[model samples]
Target: MLRRTAPCTQAPTTGTVLAGSLWHEAADPVTRRPGGPYGPLREPDVNGVALPEGFTSRIVARTGRRIGGVLWHPAPDGGACFPDGDGWIYVSNSEAPLLGGASAIRFGPGGAVVDAYRVLSGTNLNRAGGRTPWNSWLSCEEILRGRVFECDPYGSRAAMPRLAMGRFRHEAVSCDPDRGVVYLTEDEPDGCFYRFRPAYWGDLTSGVLEVLCATSDRGPVTWRRVPDPGGARAATRDQVGDAKHFSGGRGCHYADGLCLFATGGDDRVWAYDAERERLEVAYDAGAPPAAAEAVTPSGDLYVTRDGGDMEIDLITPDRVVTPVLRISGHPGSEITGPALSPGGDRLYFSSKRGPRGDASGTDGVTYEVTGPFRR
Candidate 1:
């Protein structure tokens, strides 16, 4: 998810009324290429990463390794970078069963690791989450009856579980600052897209959880309150009468006026127009199975594959798709957490299972790719 500390100048009454204001269109002339904007990949680097020319890769942390005193967590999943005083902090989630929690790595202004610490603990399967406008990170759990935990990126405040966000197998979340709501995705085969309308902007203590309702795939959608967000009796997705079902929802991203998400089971990328209250398929075919997604300042989209060749594909504003980077020799591992640095020059992600390629995820690796990315 993208992180923004800037406050909205004009608050919209609801997400639907202000959704159109966030829609962005690229104007710069793009040179169409068969490979990608940066061109074809060279040979594999020392870190077993293949990138285009003028781009480089470096390993930041490995599973069970020591970084700034504490041992790095295994199975680094979804992560986001927040702007610190001089540099920034990147927080990553561990997908390990009982040990699943989140850790953070603070960097210096020159992009050097200064500190590493734990942010959230005693959680299960900390899958993916979004960055709030208030400079906090929402770490989601992907399990039956899972909940969303709001963690302080500075490691100052205790992680709090926002029960109002609903109880389900969460995949990721995206925050719409203008509407004071956060969009959430589930990883079930019949998952539903949802939004949590907080009682007040910048607060998540109390809120009305809603699921998207539409009569058709391309919809003039509406929001219906989830009668039971806690899922005490029935799962939140089933509480709504006509809640639209999304197959394997993951990697949700919200920008100017659009919320884009990917469903791995259906192999489609869906875009919801907040202002127009319309839903449309952005990319349906001829791409890898999408899991985690991130957006650049220039409106370009980057999506990571769930399992297939361990690659991260880039989708241009013009709808051109190409592989930006691919991991070599990591057969069973998948790419996760494709987030950009605060400066928008370095890309950070991890190989979930790493070299061991076992289901235990005991040997994960996190790397950073630097290049002249389109800002």
Candidate 2:
């Protein structure tokens, strides 16, 4: 079993802590043995998927295929569902190096595709990102000295690159509306966790980027402002010597005063109590590979598998772990972007390499799994 309790050793305080004296409840590991709830998965359906009996999946879009008039971009990743009036919009990122950008599919009230369009272009290697409280999508670039593009999910406004958010191999981000800060994760072996304190609450045009620093793994942490966020003088990760290194930081999600992030290098999900200024390991073993994560209305977390048999596992608020769905014959592909619809009845994700398992992900397939999800 992973260590549930670690003495939090406080590091020497330097500068003003952004979180100040605010503190919240200590975090507990959400990992638990499987088969605790939801029972076992049924046999594969017609779509070659195994679900919890009541759920069904359908292919919503395919690579090099037309949804409306636009061709669905290949290698779809990092998606978020936004409420669009009576319907909702699902925005997904394109992980193509040269043709990197983002696209969106608008769904009607009855969960039918109303339209499809591209919202961002001229970017590179668009990876995982997060949705803001204001309904905008933060499309991140996974490249050297990359950037975060704030995109409009409705595809009405133009996407803007948030240059002040620091330059690194960004994987995903999460917005803490209460603190007016946007947390970011880098995708390197020795990457550092970061947060952007915007000049204004909702504006990303300018901000003070800070890196997390601590003396121990599960200890009190401090936020140190990065001297140069642009990486013109030195790389953002090397700017601060004492910044905590998170091996291959991948997914990040902020909810209920806790920021949960996954580090793929170690296959661990860590929870940070921003208010309490403490960190804890949420899931270390006997859990999913811990790639991208999406939280449901009932507080259950859906984590996509980074490798192996393609599947998405659900971690309930009470700590039971179970498989939500599994995709067969896609061994070379990993699941990406497990996002819930605004109504919370449908889940959206993608098989990054499709059935053929191409390295370029040119034959990716986007899927929709509908079921009696908790509201």
Candidate 3:
């Protein structure tokens, strides 16, 4: 049964409002200020990657390889890291036709891949997903009839689709455990921001799917239900009247009581305040934002650019935007699936289309970067 709790009483953190202001001002002006934590990005000694000073990375897994009886699925996209005993588990999405699903790579204490396997399969365009605080991975399918599937990262069970979450072109999801709510983003030119109030906290089996309606960036937000949860005829966006539109909505992550989402078509990252019923632009890069991942508890944000240099930009609690890593050599590929380990010392992300362009035939590559990151 679904459970209901009191509405979130937390106010928007001061840091959140400050970061929102950076969207309008100059990009990374604080970089010139003295004693910043960020330093110049160094060309990686390894091939196909680059990172900042004091940081090092290695390719953990790649597409088209066979491990544990399953072909390592191609088009490695969004992923999340989970704790597994003394080690860690990294679950990634495969954006391949027929083979699209999720793959899990278990990492040892020393950061080596101890074992890898296909945990979820037979889905469509599993682009990006988020891990719930309740110990499950919510993988999203980026196709018209796409649905959200909840996967057990430990492979204890089969992935189950949460049909009530609504059928649409889903990109990513962010869960607010405290409120038993999950925020979803659609990957269409006129996609809408969505929230699922699950019948039971952390249980997605049943819920009411609602779309946000906002007239401005600083919004007194409201919601309207999608007339059709099934994509039999009209899409949820077409059915929901007065729903707020996002340009090519992409990644979403929840932190500090706010849900942060990105629109690649508009090059903006927005924060939705559930408690206050407001939506505001947190950052605007003047170019499409590929994904937005938050460092939990700390409320810091990491966003990847949709095109061009394919750099992973970091937004500190103080609202300083800095380029942390750049995926060079791949012209058409973008850095995606920016996730932190359970401990936050290690960062994981993927370069869709690998080191070459999208036509390179090779699907993609995933990397792990370890360093002293501020919590």
Ranking by lDDT: 1, 2, 3
- Clashing pairs in model 1? 19-275, 22-256, 22-257, 23-256, 23-257
Model 1, span 1-375: residue lDDT tens:
222211111111111121322332222222334477889987899999999999999999998999985688889998888778768888899998988989999888888999999999999998878777677888999999898999997899999999889899998888887677899998899999999999997889898999999988775899999999999999888998899998888777776667877787877767788878788775565544556455664556676765557877776656566778889988889888777777678888899899779787889999989898876
- In candidate 1, which residue ranges exceed 4 Å CA deviation? 1-34
Q: Model 2: clashing residue pairs? A: 23-275
lDDT of 3 by residue, 103-153 (tens): 888878777778888778899888777777666888889998799999998
What is the lDDT for 166 in model 3?
A: 90
Candidate 1 TM-score over all chains jointly:
0.91
lDDT (0-100) at residue 147 of candidate 3? Answer: 92
Candidate 2's C-alpha lDDT? Answer: 0.77
- lDDT values for all models: 0.78, 0.77, 0.72
Residue 176 miss distance in model 2 (angstroms):
0.7
What RMSD, rounded to one decimal, does every model reach? 4.4, 6.9, 5.5
| CA deviation > 4 Å runs, candidate 2 | 1-37, 286-288
Worst 10-residue lDDT window for candidate 2 reads 3-12
TM-score of each: 0.91, 0.91, 0.88
Q: Is candidate 1 or candidate 3 better by TM-score?
A: 1
